[model samples]
Target chain A: MPKLIDFKLILTNIPDLLQYLPITLGIVLLSMVVGLVLALGIALVRLHKIPVLNQIFTVLVSFVRGTPLLVQLYLSYYGVPIALRYWNYYNHTNFNINHVPAFLFVFVAFAINEAAYNSENIRGALLSVDDGEIEAAETLGMTGWQILRRITIPEALVVALPTLGNQFISLIKGTSLAFVAGVIEMTAEGQIIAGRTFRYFEVYLSLAIIYWALTVITEILIRLIEKRINRFRVAQHLVGTPAPTETPIVGAQVLASKEVRS
Target chain B: MITIEHLAKKFDDHQIFSDINLEIQTGEIIGIIGPSGSGKSTLLRCLNLLETPDAGTITIDDQQIVAPHITKAQRLKFRQASTMVFQQFNLFRQKNAWENVAEGLITVKKIPKDEAKARALQELDRVGLAPYANFYPEQLSGGQKQRVAIARSLATDAKLLLLDEPTSALDLELVGEVLQTLKQVVLDHPNFTVILVSHELGFVQEVASRVLFFDDGRIQEAGTPDEVLVHPQHERTKQFLARFATQTVHN
Candidate 1:
């Protein structure tokens, strides 16, 4: 049997692949920011059940979520240019597809895909927030926007954070599909190097390791955020103190944030 | 003062309550006692426009709103005049006890953070939960959480405070503590009007200035606690009181 494994080649290719890491990370960050904003707007409309628009978004989100992401990428890659051409034709204006970057389609597709899934996660989190709390906020004379900002979003994000982290990790991996739209991200760079060297195993293995490392790092960051957000719970668990009944407040163990203390 | 006239609510075609009329005096603690599904909660919710009534006019303090046609500004003004304490003690999970009390003051009242914190701490002190000011609701008992909610309500200077089954969600052992807290709140603030919906007849009888026996979405009888609880007039009121009487005698 010929040498089936090449550890040295894998090590060499890893450094070469690392150069494109920024592109991969940039795509994930951009898509996540855009996707999260879209998802929140979609989820809010659904939660409020805004007549006809709510129904339309419900169908749109369902249709987006139900379809394969690869198909969506292909649709964007091929469809956007056509749609633009049609728009230009109708208005007798000049617009060109060649001026648009191919990577833009990939970004649009991934963001839409991420949004459809994340909106459900956010909506579930929103619903899980006790109705009683919202009622309390309302009766306190806070407007709907104020309640959403101060109570609903902060609390819902806490519940939705873990799932959102998972979505981001998946989104990072989802960026690999960008190669199909002719966007040379990390995986595409790997493919170009592999094609030249005929080192399929090492290149593919390096890609997998990069993605795994990204996911692990992202998960660790998410855990730290979760811990920070739930600091009171952590403190309670650490103290192991039984809840006191009718005890006069004596010493202050303040968790007061600067904003509150100010 | 709060006044409701010709209040009606319907779920699809089925009526929850219809043509309800009432005038609530300023500073009075009114107890609403009724059978389950008799629309007591619905009636309470309608007062604050939580559940939009199909037809009604609610006048709270200086603001008035016609049912189902309430403008956003009127709704906001009406809500500012009143606050509600939920049975489930709907404390904000993200907030510790003091933060829960301070939230409305800071956000709605536009009080400075330092002042809001002071007011929250004072309200918590009033409810005897000042020691647990930093504790989250999960770390507190049911009664303690309810007291925190009560503190939150008190932090806002709403003229009308609505208590919806305040003690019903508490454990048997914890009920007395919350009931005691509510009693103290009622006695201390005679100028703060309250509409209390409760299943605890004894607590209601003790704290309520007047009791309304509600049946079929209408006030069947309205009088002092002694009149409603001891010397009931309506047949439904008698039947409702008889169950409590049997339970009391059995105990």
Candidate 2:
């Protein structure tokens, strides 16, 4: 009789699955970079409520958010080649749809999916900045672009960072769907190894362990970054800091007497 | 010099102020006092085009802006002519005291970074905040934050300064430091026109060279503090001062 369980196969499957780890990470890294840029653009368009473009992007973001990632990957994978064929026929161009890489479709789908979710996170953060500070900046004669660059965006980033970090973790798990586009990432590699060995449970368990470890690492890195950026807040909680120079009691009384109406 | 004519504003159906007219001489400290919803703060905001008036024109120095038709250049020029201190002491939370003071200098005035830093330090020094230059808004007390805000406005070198209830958010004890700083600013820069809206009747009386009693979206009374705060000509002005009278005695 065949052995009931191949406990050793789980260990052996990890290194084999690890071979394709870079591909999975590559999709996440590239998509994160592209998605962040797209999200910022979408958030700004929505925040400012710019004309027709705002409505167009609003619907586009809704559709991406409402639909499943796998469906999105399938649509881009199958849809782009057909669209390209129609374009080549109409434009009288000789573009080759067959030469397009599978990973490009996966990258496009993941980035769009990430942008739709992250834009809301960014918009909330942008709105969270105090109106008072922006007014102060405006009163200082800073232009619209100057206020956004110097004051709004920097302040908004502090508010957005934690949510954006969570989005990144979700994006990592979302990249598992890359196999739907025919790209053999870690998940796809696990399935291939499972199919050959008929040890599906063991192979998947190893894959889960790797993904869990990756998530843990990402969380730690995000926390470190948060602590570093929030250093200015450290002084407020310190127990024994030196007091500020001005004597509050004396200052108040002198001001009241010297400047009072009576 | 500043001139306002037929100024008006409304939030939907609720009118904030309307058909307001006034002329302000250069180098004058103008105190505006009124009830809570009397549009005093909105009027100060309208002067710097912070609130876009629905109908009116504001002329500051050589630049003039008519409501609903303010050009970008006109708004920029008007803003450059004045700065504001908020009641909340709205210092940038992300920056230190010196950076807050230096921000307008570097970003708006396009001064060199080192020179801007020096000027910012000088302004902070004027407010007695030079030692706390590295402190963030959260690290400082309410009064210190306001002083940093004052330093920021002063460093811009705007001819006009608008203070909206500057000490209203401070602790009773902390109010004096901000009041002292404002008194010094007025004494040090006699040419800098200040438009202050405050419930601190005492400070307004001490610092304001001319006073305006704003109510129902109009200047109900305008004169020296003695005329409005002491010998008020309007019934509403007298009633307003009377309410403060009881509060002062209670304190």
Which residue runs of candidate 1 sit more than 4 Å off their true CA positions? A1-5, A232-262
Cα lDDT computed for each candidate against the true fold: 0.87, 0.89
Stretches > 4 Å off in candidate 2: A1-16, A194-202, A235-262
Give the range of the ten consecutive residues with the poorest summed lDDT in model 1 chain A. A234-243
Count of steric clashes across candidates, in order: 1, 0
TM-scores for all candidates: the values are 0.91, 0.90
Provide the DockQ value for model 1.
0.49
What would the per-residue lDDT of candidate 2 be over residues B167-221, giving only the tens digit for each residue? 9998899899899999999999999999999999988999899999998888999
List fnat, each candidate.
0.63, 0.54
**lDDT, residue A153, candidate 1:** 92
Kindly list the per-residue Cα lDDT of model 1 for residues B61-151, writing each as its tens digit. Answer: 7788887988888888788888898989999988889999999999988999999999999999899878778877777788889999999
lDDT for each residue of candidate 1 in A1-262, tens digit (9 for 90 to 100): 7888998888788889999999888888988999999999989999989999899889989999889888898999999999999999999988888999987998899888888899999999999888888998988888989998998998898899989998998899989989888888999999999899998989999999989999999999999999998775532231224435454444334332322344
Docking class of 2: acceptable
- lDDT (10s digit) by residue, model 2, range A139-235: 9988999999988988888889999999999888888889888999999999998889899999989999999999999999999988877755634
